[model samples]
Target: MPQWWKEEIVYQIYPKSFQDSNHDGIGDIQGIIQKLDYLKDLGVTMLWICPIYCSPMDDNGYDIADYYQIHPDFGSMEDVDELIVKAKERDIKIIMDLVINHTSDEHAWFQEALKNPDSPYRQYYIFKEGQDNQPPTNWRSVFSGSVWEKVPHEDNMYYFHSFSKKQPDLNWENPQMREDIYRMINWWLDKGIAGFRVDAINFIKKDQSWQNGPVDGADGLSSCFEFTRNQPGIEVFFKELREKTFDIHHCMTVAEAVGVPYDQLSIFIGQDGCFSMMFDFNYSHIDITEHEEWFPLQNWTMQEYKEKLFLSQKEIFKTGWCGTFLENHDMQRSLNRLIRNPQERTPKAAKALGQMFMFLKGTPFIYQGEEIGTINNHRLSIHDFDDLNSHAQYRRALQEGYSEEEALDFVNRRSRDNTRSPMSWNSQLYAGFSDVQPWLTNNEYYQDINVAKQVNDPDSVLSYYKQMIALRQNPLYHQTLVYGDFISLESEEYVIAYMRQDDQQTILCIQNLQNKETHFPLSSKAQVLLSNDQVNIQNQQLKLSPYQATILLIE
Candidate 1:
């Protein structure tokens, strides 16, 4: 039986930049409520909203201070309740971000842990004694710093954090801490939320050895990922987590699980797996180096990207399911990343990329502003950026002997802020995202690419996405589009072609991934179902224009 979640299309909303209702320059629950109809019109079944919990806004609400309270910048709990009820009315389920891997330093548990080393709360977080007046281990944080931060006025005491210093890593080794996390999860599930998008859940379990890894950069500190990401015993915690919370509530879960090997796919996402699905970052991070550094972007070919994506799809198809996403809060816009030629970054190219990913054998996720083909933001200076990771990358690039212009260029091409820009609803003062200045700068191209200009236009990227969604949801072809096997078609390097096959029908999706025309042999029985451009089919040969994407149903 096909799962409901598998057939559902998800839309991710980064609350801060989605829309502002109170003119407070920050997006809120009310703003989301106002956009419910828009999402419904876009045909998404679920909304995976980023964290809106009470926080100091460190890491943009990922450093949660209180799981029970809503962030003031967003709105009160009443607003959230209204949003849930309203979104449900629109047939859209809400999925909140589960960030249990860590908590804000200001969280009561962490504050108590810091106040007295002997407090029971101290056991809730990881704390270690320093050696030789230095951090216990030489592990580097994800945001480019030592993972250990020394305790102020305390003798040789330090705490562990995988990301920001303000976010303390939770000690899953403590049974009590695990119980608390499960309880909190259940509480939210009981509130009528459909599920959760688990954040960095793989980093919860750490290697007990606490050994330093090989230093891969000039910082001398080793990457903490080896010591904390997807360790041996992590499955135990995952099993427990599902049994206690998700399993009981029958909630859908998609994990942001990096470093999970192909062999472990069944354990993480099958029938007995911990999550319903997981996001595969193999193809998404293709432009970056293996170390995930932003500077000196790695050169990649279309074939390489195709191989990575195909491998992931094939492996996951063998075990469980996958979450197909090209853009997220943590990634740059897909239009900017996928289309190499800036001149080809048009509505046609955006529609081509959208159609290419929508029919893959998985649940599709569309990030905010992705429907209208949002592109990367090119800020003039490093000071203009807001993401902590961007600043870290800039400094790291400089430390690696790159000039300021080069560092900013790298940031421009890969910064998370590129996708974090306020959604361009209209050509109003702040791109219709807010009445006043938005929390983040509006993309300069909003004047031409805003939703208001494309909402009703048949040729717009937004309209094309709606058409693709409708095609997927159509009962006549739903079986083949949703549950069919993915078979990669052998084609030229620049052309990506695949067939989704079932016992009844075969749906072929092909794309010209370059800025030049291409030719591919086509079956005479193939019928055009959808296309981004005017494809020429003559004499059993299909002529594809620049960046053309087409879908055909083979009779």
Candidate 2:
């Protein structure tokens, strides 16, 4: 590997929502190809696209119908090849999603497995005979249902699904199945695509016996997080996959890892590693109450958020590489959800948060619309919801005693649909996404927040982000930002402060997360290179206005 991933700014593209090329109201490969220049000008180094593989779109392409083929809605194999060619020309590497934890029930392999009980394909899934009115295991699916769903055709038999029942778990225990997966991965890498963002990668390995899991959370169904996910034997499978596919291309693989223990960080991303890096979810997990099923209704304090994120950055710096991100297809936008008031959500706060994470000792992944302060929509009613996860959480909340209105608030605040909403391209009908109706409703804020306006405005959040990326990639800051050790400046509430330093220069970062002014002194005369707010500095210190931030280079 060329260590290219360490220095890259990864921009995530949700295909169906990114752009509509044919005015068919669906984003396709052609749409992506047309926007390569936009991404290049934005200074993005790599692209992490949500699954474009053949799928039912049940979970928005997470339910894969075919591993190697492009989804008809997106385009054909030829369009994919052209995208790779165009992206590479702009120095933009394309990273596809690898959703191998489960395959769509409609996939040929799964269909064949169901058709013939004696067939070799039968061993390609986790089908078990029911025992004494019990499921194959007591484990609950991540998506609010039972893990095992009965296969009515096969008397007394059931198959496992870690997510939706429409998506059946692949039998990773099957050697043949592993071989097939590797072959598909190699095929993509061979096409000159840079690498992959492996989805639900931790779920690929589980305890062989579907034994009872320990109840560790407030919600009744214990989080299979402890025992079922990232279980002991993952390294072997990852090593094999790496040697067979990723190693050949030196591909950047950022495993979508969540519950992997801090102690195991090095093992997964060591210098001699199983993956180039894995996403650090400490900030996200901070809100995960001791409840298994609830979608964390607890609001986070600013200091708590700071500590969780800083700890993960510090942990990765000590052990191995990590993926730095605030928003993704699966979560709400950071600017909207993280800030208290929309009025207080200034471009300064946006830029500072961008710089704080991007300069960490790892790769930074930017979710779509994060550049120009894309807030989640408030008009979506329960009936308007499309994300299955959001629906499941709403039902779970009602079951847990929240009123209908209360549950609705949870969905509006936390729905993945918040991020999954159609990308706002221009101030047109449906935000210039398409001429026809869109798969999901566009955020109404798109009227003022579209890309066309921000792309040209020097003071826009989009412009600040463009400047931030360029600064990180600058000849002076590139090495420090990519490889510098992270050191925390404080542990107090509502304040996140750190410094990134190499042999040449030391960069001081401070953010006033609260709505109160924060004052702190610095060591020497330092140039304020970046700020989420206007700066006023005096003798060795800086006064951060409410929700303000500053990035300084020491003399």
Q: Highest lDDT among the candidates is held by which one?
A: 1
Backbone clash total for model 1 is 0
Model 2 ranges off by over 4 Å: 214-222, 290-296
TM-score of each: 0.99, 0.96
lDDT of 2 by residue, 4-89 (tens): 78888999999999888987889988999988898999999899988999999889999988878899889999999999888888
lDDT of each: 0.91, 0.82
Worst 10 residues of 1 by lDDT: 1-10
Q: Write the per-residue lDDT of candidate 1 for residues 1-555, one digit (tens) a residue.
A: 436789889999999999999998999999999999999999999999999999998799999999999999999999999999999999999999999999999999999998998899999999999889889999989898899999888999999999999999999999999999989999999999999999999999999998778988787888888898878988899889999998898889999998688998776899878999999987889988766788797888889998888888899989999899879999898888877889989889898889888988999999999999989878999999999999998988898889999999999999999989999999878999998888889999999888999999999999999999999999999989999999998899888899999999999999888888989998657889999988688898989998899999987
Look at candidate 2 and give me any clashing residue pairs. Answer: 218-290, 348-532, 349-532, 521-541, 522-540
TM-score of structure candidate 2: 0.96
Model 1 alpha-carbon drift over 4 Å, by segment: none
Error of 2 at 204 (Å): 1.4
Q: What is the C-alpha RMSD of each candidate to the true structure, in Å?
A: 1.0, 1.9
